[model samples]
Target: MNTTRGADGKRTGRDETAEERADRMWVELIQEVRVAQTGVQILFGFLLTVVFTPAFARLAHTDRVIYIVTVVLGAAATGALIGPVSLHRLVSGRRVKPQAVSLASRLTFVGLVLLLATMTSSLLLVLRVATQADYVLLLVAVVVLWYLLCWFGWPLWVRHRHTSEQ
Candidate 1:
């Protein structure tokens, strides 16, 4: 087997030579991060405003805990999502783009996971306050499953299927 190295002496791509596919994956990852950052930022900003709302004063103790957890998770998501930018900035000309991109990708994944938690808790708080349905927990569980499927399950499935076919 032959392998190529980038300027920084690091192997690039998915254990293959750095080629068009690696470039495309990098672009896709950056795009995904952009979309996620936008959503998390907006959601986090809204969560920040909730503390000042009149209704916040009337929230039950459990609801308040949920709100706090959601806010903290949102903050963590924001940090992780923005991490790529900082990573790129610091290493922009270090001739280690491949390594930086890999690290940034991990940060983005962590951010997405945090974002999922934030969204779940946020939804739970909203639904719990909006109604007294006995199936609220079930509804949340369903939505979580949906997120896991869309965010992770589908991607992993595609990766495995493609690898097997190849």
Candidate 2:
């Protein structure tokens, strides 16, 4: 039944030292990154094959441009998502795990944002090609909003609410 305050004089609500917390965070972050990385990698792989398809040649110039942007975003997402692994490898045994974890978390956030853009653009391109409807933009907009809410908005809200309560 003992508790301690963090350096900031705030209850951390956990019984672990900073190093222990960082280690746990690193493991959790890697697991999250793995899931996102798998999704982005698969999407990127499919995107890479799109250009070789006969249908690609028939795409309008605008669609081609969107495809290029999507591909670039996917590549960036892949890099950001994979960054933590290399980061950990290079910084291993440096006694800077807390700093490393902070950097890795930032990279993972960047990756998720990039993945959102990649997914939005990919959806737009596919719907445009398949449906050829003016409503495609509307549908994509709605989906993007959903992604924003699910990925960022809800998490931020929860953090803010709970932190304030504490």
Candidate 3:
């Protein structure tokens, strides 16, 4: 068995070569992507149906524009989230798991960002339609802040606070 200090200088306590590490990371990344992929795919599917609703024609020009933007964001999110699968398929057995993992991680991160935008836009459209009030943007801003805090801020804070410098 072998052990090595990781980025934070803590011993990983695992006997794994670079290829093994890449394999493990790839599996974990794929699992995480599956969860995000489901959400984004469902959201995109729902967005696709909005245009067919009779009420869609009655929406104000601003609301319609918002819908278009939201749908585009949703599509982008779906594409990014699913990109890893396609990437893996194309690169499988090429002895490049390490590079594939790195690229897949980047794609997942982009997907998450796109997902955030889609959610914000969808919420804005919903609130505007449900309540024609000036406070809608304020509410959307608050929600976006909450999402950022939960999705990125807290994790970063934890990493910064707990990680040891070497």
- Report, for all candidates in order, the number of backbone clashes: 0, 0, 0
Which prediction has more favorable lDDT, 1 or 2? 2
User: Over the full model, what C-alpha lDDT does candidate 2 score relative to the true structure?
Assistant: 0.94
**Residue 120 alpha-carbon offset, candidate 3, angstroms:** 0.2
TM-score of 3: 0.93
Instruction: Give the Cα lDDT of each candidate.
Output: 0.88, 0.94, 0.93
For candidate 2, give the lDDT of residue 87.
Answer: 99
Candidate 3: 10-residue stretch with minimal lDDT = 1-10
Rank all candidate structures by their TM-score, best first, as comma-separated numbers. Answer: 2, 3, 1
Model 2 per-residue lDDT tens digits across residues 20-131: 8889889999999999999999999999999999999999999999999999999999999999999999999999998999999999999999999999999999999999
Query: Per-residue lDDT of 1-166 in model 3, one digit per residue for the tens?
Result: 4555576767766678777788999999999999999999998999999999999999999999999999999999999999999999999999999899999999999999999999999999999999999999999999999999998999999999987654
The regions of model 1 sitting more than 4 angstroms off are: 1-25, 164-166
Give every collision pair in model 1: none
Candidate 1 residues 72-165, lDDT tens each? 9999999999998898789877767777788989999999999999999999999999985788899999999999999999999998877432
Residue 11 local lDDT, model 2: 72
Which has the higher lDDT value, candidate number 1 or candidate number 3? 3
Give the per-residue Cα lDDT of candidate 2 at 130. 96
